[model samples]
Target: MAGKLSVLAVVALATAAVFPSSVSAQPPLPPGPVTMIVGWPAGGPSDAVARLVGAHMAKALNQPVMIDNRAGAGGNIGSDAAARARADGSTIMLATVASHGLNSALYTRLNHDPLKDFAPIGLITTSPSVLLVPRDSPLHSVRELIEKARAQPGKLNYGSGGVGSSQHLAGASFKKLAGVDIAHIPYKGTAPAMTDLMAGRVDLVLTTGAMSFIRSNKVRALAVAAPRRLPALPDVPTFDEAGLKGFHTDSWYGLVAPAGTPRPVLEQLNAALATALRDPELERQFSEQGSLPVKPMGVDEFWNFVRKQMPTAAEQVRISGAKAE
Candidate 1:
């Protein structure tokens, strides 16, 4: 009995040494407010998600989470700032697919490395782009639109928020897969592109933030660029279902702190992010806006996910032939 007890005691000590309790492993953030940088203008999708998730994270961290918008260079401006911020848990950034995934492939020179410059905390939400046309337009389906584009070739045009934006890539992907020659019109932002789409100045648009217009019947969603249909737009068909077999694109947001932030601090921030995402009300709000929170994941797992997405983003950038302005 004594021998058995001794062996059990040794095993327990070894286990404790290898894995500490969560309560002791996580350290508190710095005293002042945590600034969350958004690499887009306020009132944009990334800003909206940051404000929502930051409000909930503030409750979890018991510190005010301030949103700082640093809009420019396709999210590079804010991302560069976040990459340079001190790694003391005082600052973080709301990263997007644009910043971490596509920009590296789109821009020839960047100040910061997407993978090495930051530590991924967790994914916030994903917004899938939808193929939209004016409600009163004669084209009612993706097939019709593709046929028209094929017939007119460069005479037809599609509009996007910018050169390397997800919208542009989606439209590019459509042109590649459908083998059509449609001219691309780049606007300052999606708002202007959407306005042009409605006014018939542009033939079509692929955007993530046009759900309200779809719901209000102002625009008709011909297809969604996702494997499955969105709950908010169930009536819409997937691109695959609409005759384009293997098309997909999404705009995603995630939380990240500067690289070299202590692993424990990263763990703490990820925990707070997971807790905030668990709020049923937050999930409801996200769904109402046609966004979906990502499934829970630990810090390293989230980083791994981001790493795996880079190659695909690069391929899309190549397909789009987009260059930074």
Candidate 2:
């Protein structure tokens, strides 16, 4: 019995020596609420999607996720704030095409580099811009619009949310590919741009789906920028189908955290986002709003996609002479 007791004491000492309390310690994950910053104003597509996905993310994380809207400077102001945030994974930016990838080339001086300053979490959704004209306008199709624009260079004007926006890039790409010339008219937002297009103040607008005004015959969709037709706009032909090969551009939104965030934290967030994206109700809501829900890919894949797109988008900005305010 004495020998057995001594042996047990030796075993306990060895176990404690091998496994210290510090060896098992792990820093606690953010216990409080996480904030999602949307660069666009409320009631926009980005805001709507952020709120929808954020709710599910909150449930998966077992914490509340609040939305912060900071709209200005073509999404630069809010994006800069996100990039400057601490690398703690507590603050995330709901970044769009204008703020993340395109701004690098469009702006002469940026507060942050999209590729180096932020760690990509995952892609959320893509809202392809559609080319549209007034319903009563003589331009019946994309080809017709191009031909008219070519014949009357600088006579036709196109409306966009603003310079350096996805809308502007799409319009510029169309002009370059189709070999047409038209004046670009910049507006503060898509709503005002669409309004001007309907009022005949502008000849056309390459913008998001016009579902609300479609029923009223306010505008006519000429072509969709996606590879295939959207379900909501089945009658509209894609740019490739409309006689412009390899012409596709869309405003995509994704999740991004400040640079230097832990890899484990990013992976966990990506997994949660993937689960939220798989929800049926989320898909339905996105479709109803004329946006497509993109399945969340791994962090590396998301980063690769953004990196590959930067040069092409940058060249478009250069060619379009888009500038940041």
lDDT of each structure? 0.84, 0.81
Stretches > 4 Å off in candidate 2: 1-29, 215-217, 319-325
- TM-score of every model versus the real structure: 0.85, 0.83
Instruction: List, residue by residue over 229-271, the lDDT tens digit for candidate 2.
Output: 9998888899899988888777788899999877777877888
Q: How many steric clashes between backbone atoms does each model show?
A: 0, 0
Clashing residue pairs found in predicted model 2: none
Q: Give Cα distance to truth, residue 217, candidate 1, Å.
A: 3.0
Residue 194 error for model 2, in Å?
A: 2.6
lDDT of 1 by residue, 1-325 (tens): 9999999999999998899776566556778799999876665566678899999999999999999988766778888999999997899999888888888888889999998899878888888888888878899898999899888879888887776667777888789889989888876557678888888888899878676677888888899888998888888899999998988888888999999887888888999999999999889878866786679789888888899998989988887666665
